[model samples]
Target: MNSVRNPVLRSFCGWLTALLVVASVAFASGEVRAASFQPLEIVTQSGVQVFSVEIATTEEEKTTGLMYRKELPDGKGMLFDFSPEQQVSMWMKNTYISLDMIFIRADGRILRIAENTEPLSTRIIPSGGLAKGVLEVSAGTAQKYGIRPGDRVAHPLFNGH
Candidate 1:
């Protein structure tokens, strides 16, 4: 009988297994982490920073927007770039995580923040004004990060100043 008791190898194996599980789950769940991640930054008038999110550029991707996920890690979010500023409405219909939807104008200025939306609710969440995008983050993110209408969001989809 051979006993393999190398702690380093055991640790590596455990880590590998965890990675594999996460990858499989993510893959099976349709790559919600993102097909290709992009950096999205939000800066307040007084230099306060809020979010750094991934951009969701396609209709299919935006439609999927964080549905069926058991957890949403901290400091992470999805940006649905709906281009050409228009009225926007969202729902938590198939979504499993409570979210704060931050709507932005064509120029990337925050227009509204729909906070603490109930998970799996069919309620319509609307942007009070024409918006070019919606940033979806874990519930409480808006309050926690001091994000508010008028703040600036930086991304390629916006007319950054």
Candidate 2:
């Protein structure tokens, strides 16, 4: 029986080790790029919280609003944008969790808040009046923090749409 070490195999192992080290360093330094979003964190007058929200500004995105998501992170929410402000209606057609939708004007002022919307219900949740943006957070979050019409949504994304 003959035992021999392959140089090619040794080189391959060294290259793999180097690649893994680079990847590890990138991850440790938070330099690893995410292929998808990490959920948005929003703060209202109530406090800081995290939530997973889908942004719906365009006709298409709004059509698919939070259809299949099952979990919602606390303090995180979605900002739906609309160009040329008008009344918007949202429904929990495919949504699996209850949400509180906060309607905001173009200036980021809260116009109306629909809280504790039933999940998977087709009930029409209207924005009441013209609004430029809508934020969806966990159920009852709006009332818990005293978020009401006229309160401003202080986020940089609220420029116009």
Each model's Cα RMSD: 7.8, 9.1
Worst 10 residues of 2 by lDDT: 30-39
Q: What tens-digit string does per-residue lDDT give for candidate 2 at 22-128?
A: 98876455343213233443456676545555555566566656666666766666677775678888899878789999887777678898989999999999989
Question: lDDT of each structure?
Answer: 0.84, 0.71
Q: What are the TM-scores, per candidate, against the unseen true structure?
A: 0.77, 0.65
Candidate 1 residues lying further than 4 Å off, grouped into runs, are 1-31
Candidate 1 residue lDDT tens string, 30-50: 466556667777886556554
Q: What is the alpha-carbon lDDT for the whole of candidate 2?
A: 0.71
Model 1 scores a TM of 0.77
Whole-model lDDT for model 1 versus the true structure?
0.84
